[model samples]
Target: MGRKNISDQRRGEIIISFYEVSRSLGLENASIAKLAQHMGISKGLVLHYFKNREELLLGLNEYILEQHLRVMVSEDIGKMDCKEHVIHFIENLFTRAWNTYFDDGVFYSCYALVYRVPEFKESFKAYLIQLHEVLYKKLEEAVAFDVIVATDLKELTEVIFALIDGAYYYLGMYNEHDLAYKQQIAIYVKYSLRLLDFRS
Candidate 1:
């Protein structure tokens, strides 16, 4: 692997290929050789853009975060009603697309690495904090519009994130066929709405 400049498109291709290979091969087992082969690029080229596995993983994490924001938060926050915005946030978190976007194995591998690697720990922690901030902002908007009556923004933000994370983890552990999965998600959504004191 030599130092060479790569186009942003090439870098994105490598990141995506890394994700595809890692998902199939398991992140720990997915070697740079496999990633290079998957992308049909030379190993040196992969290294040219990402100096090492740690750098690649961090880049992948950033890519995942950006993709999530694009897909899950497409609507302008100021344009939607408070209730609609709140529902949007919940639906995106529990949706099948969300599961696909963060494939169970790859997502958990990243999660586990956060605890073991100090550098990854900070990057992953920042990602979670950003997620909380986004949710908190939406909740604040909801309160302003009287969508949830009155609420404690900080406490409610923690509760909401916990509920979503718990349900997502539960569903991942017991991933079933589409029908059963949908049923479970429906139940989760209902319960989450109840927590927000949300009414039709």
Candidate 2:
């Protein structure tokens, strides 16, 4: 039993190492040898947990998707008003999701690969669509409860998502201050609500 547990732990570590490498170097460049060197492990050891590069890339995508789901489906969304919730969500996203996964060059590499690489496009798009759906549902709930006065939930949700995405991208590329990111997102959210004539 102890041996089995150790093996499981090692396997988990290998997966995490692969994810880190992929996030930093892009899936195509995060080769097994490079990952092994980074993790201080042998190529055979990585192969023990994953059959090949494809398997490792797939596992990385799954791990990233799971993390995204956890952030998007946070319970905090259900507990706060639309304005507070949206602001809180955006703030948390920058502090948690952005800071955690994307504090280095690796994330940019992964982003470039995910969008430009035809093979990974489907997984990337699926993850984005899932995120959008979750946000849409949360925004729709806010509308139903009269927290936001938007008649078109879909459009409002897209606007919010786009605003947040744009803010994060800009912050990631040039600025690196949490305060500025939050301020920009807050302003966008307020402007969006006001444009929709949402009175709250």
- Cα lDDT tens digits, model 1, 80-141, are 25677777677767765665466778888888998888998898888888888877777766
> For every model shown, what is its TM-score relative to the native structure?
0.82, 0.73
lDDT by residue (71-130, candidate 2, tens digit) is: 777776554366677556555654435455433354445556666667666767787888
| Top-TM-score structure, candidate number | 1
Overall lDDT per candidate, in order of appearance: 0.77, 0.68
Error of 2 at 38 (Å): 4.0
Cα-based lDDT at residue 170, candidate 2: 67
Error of 2 at 55 (Å): 3.0
Deviation (Å) of 83 in candidate 1: 3.5
Report each candidate's C-alpha RMSD, comma-separated, in the order given.
3.8, 3.9
